[model samples]
Target: MQLPLPPSPMALPLSGRFPAPFLPPSMRKAGLLHPIASASLSPTIKDETIDWVEATSNFFEKDTRPIMLFDGVCNLCNGGVRFVRANDRNRRIRLEALQSDAGKKLLRRSGRAPDDISSVVLVEKDRSYIKSEAVLRIMEYLELPFPQLALFLQFVPLFVRNIVYDNIADNRYTLFGRSESCEI
Candidate 1:
């Protein structure tokens, strides 16, 4: 008589491969094993801690600019920066690549992770905004018809607006193409 075959390897010790209930609490809390956590934990910068004096000093010393932070490697982003500069006419807006050291510092000081910032960032003395909010805030600072666009914020829901913004951002390279170099 043939003996019964043992259970397949896949059927044995399922918990060994996939410990649904035995995973460490820290791993579960982090959602994933992030490199930042592995390195060292430090106090995150608070919005109230932004040094306006330092930011303004850097802006003046670097280029006497307003410090617009954008994706340094994105072609569409570079073009958009140029467009904003051209439209400003007054030349009030200054630019910096998010990849730059200064940009990273500012982001950190603002309680944001540089790697996680995918949209344009406009930082002022003590405040910051992201995505569509950043765009609208910039327009408001332009001090003219651009400020009128801020009215759109009232009519559009934040969730709906972010969806459109995120879609464009996700496909910007494919739709608008990319640049070989990061332009200021």
Candidate 2:
């Protein structure tokens, strides 16, 4: 649901080893896209469109921290969050249950349906990725050998990756077993 808006004036430069560009124009225009931005921004939808920068810039000003939003009640998702928390050695990642207020707000800001909880979302500076894209983004940030694997997977077509991701998501609850509470 991300808007196809024109580029902004203050777009930031992309960085890091992850091939993904920093603040792609789409993300930059949509707002909520800064490497060190805040995730507390709340966007208002109006006239069948969002105010974009006005609604997002206030919340993400100077903060580009990535927000990881996952399905709260899904055991598989919870485990994934736990794994991220434990292995993100520098504590570079921030997490939220998709059912939480913050997470919903982020989803909306990213122009995604807030109710769609099947996908894991990675909110990076100026861009948001879901499903297989989100997975690859997370993997790209991981330490060493894993990043290598992510790089290898990047060569596959996106549709193929999404199909694989969809299969796993479709059966994760049955395979992993859901818990009464999301403990991640």
Candidate achieving the largest TM-score: 2
Clashes of each: 1, 7
Q: Please, what are the lDDT tens digits per residue for candidate 2 over residues 106-134?
A: 76656555676878888776777888878
- Candidate 1, superposed: residue stretches over 4 Å from native: 1-66
For candidate 2, the TM-score is 0.70
lDDT of 1 at 168: 91
Q: Each prediction's TM-score against the native?
A: 0.63, 0.70
Off by over 4 Å in 2: 1-59
Query: 47, model 2: CA deviation in Å?
Result: 5.2
lDDT of 1 by residue, 75-111 (tens): 8898878778767887777787888888876665444
RMSD of each: 15.1, 9.7
